[model samples]
Target: MDMMMVIYNGLLSDEYIKGQATGRIKFYEYPPTGDISGPYIVIDPLGPPQSADYGDNIPIKDDYLYQIDVWTKNRLVTKELSKRVQKVMRSIGFGYFAGGVDEYDKDTGIYRDARRYRGKAYTEEFEI
Candidate 1:
């Protein structure tokens, strides 16, 4: 399953809209080039997927771990964005159990809060 697409769609869902008063925000799969404004989210896979036991080697279920970074000029805004992201991911069936402010870049004046979520997609049946 395309986990990034799932996350992107969830952020644009109605639930996210009603949860915050923030204006139009940008979302990127990876870091973007050129000048950009505050209040944007970046979704990136942390690393390669680790093996989860697949009974009978059918591969009916897949789990991926990813990182969602919320960046903004204001610390409070960053935190709020992170919370909304967590809610959205949860709504989309992702299990988000760990996250926190990873770092603050003084050079760019951006506060980034990173969240880790495990997304699992399963099929009822799969042919070998």
Candidate 2:
């Protein structure tokens, strides 16, 4: 489960994601303390990975559910970055795009698009 975060953190380093996000791409869901403003991304696992497939009663694969959040002041950037993130997620074998929902922080006036994805371990992207 923890390794999935590492995989996502490693795979989301594409140029589109890097260029659009003005802030850091953190591993946790919560935003960092203080005002490190501009567009940012947060990656977090929903829960423990579910065991799938069995080989001699031993688990052979695991299903993972993860959430990727895009936060920004601009709606366009949020939407575009969300797509770019989906692209990256697909590239890493996260074929299950569970879609996203719009969220706003009234106090900060920041827009967020929270997207969910499901993938399996031992796939092309998840080597471990």
Candidate 3:
């Protein structure tokens, strides 16, 4: 495996897209709260990727497109993994959604609100 790829997987590389593989977004369901779900990924059980230490003299390249390809593959798998979660949420009459976030205000965050409810009852669903 490429050293850069290792760094990407370790989530230490600046070139890496954080949380791109596991796409889970905060969401809620109002009204009857019947249930709703969205796309997700599924990871297969397998040993870690083949890797070997490539000392300090490492190289990075623009032609290193495999990183993006691998990320895509991983994302697809992760989407499959999300099936289990969707099933569980549906069973409980909840909602499930996933996506990337550009920013967040964690300190004073208003997570979920029903657009039809006139913002009278806001609920915060913590990530489990």
What TM-score fits each model? 0.71, 0.78, 0.20
- Higher-scoring candidate on TM-score, 2 or 3: 2
Estimate the TM-score for candidate 1: 0.71
Tell me how candidate 3 scores on lDDT: 0.25
Q: How close is candidate 2 to the true structure, as a TM-score?
A: 0.78
Which of the numbered candidates is closest to the native, going by highest lDDT?
Answer: 2
Which lDDT tens digits does candidate 1 get at residues 1-128?
55676777678774543344234433444344323364667777776655554878756666778787777677887787788888888887777757555677777777778888887676435423
Cα error of candidate 1 at position 97, Å: 4.7
- Which candidate order results from sorting by TM-score in descending order? 2, 1, 3
Task: Give candidate 2 misplaced runs (Cα > 4 Å).
Answer: 9-11, 32-36, 97-99, 123-128
The deviation in Å at residue 128 for candidate 2 is: 9.0
Highest TM-score: give the candidate number. Answer: 2
* Candidate 1 Cα errors over 4 Å, as ranges: 14-36, 48-56, 97-100, 123-128
1 or 3, which is superior by TM-score?
1
**1-128: candidate 3 lDDT, tens digit per residue:** 23232323333221122344333221221212212233212222122232222325432211111111111123333333333333332343323333322222244231221111000111112112
- Per-model root-mean-square deviation over C-alphas: 4.2, 3.6, 20.4
Query: Against the hidden true structure, what lDDT does model 1 obtain?
Result: 0.67
Candidate 3 — worst ten consecutive residues by lDDT sum? 114-123
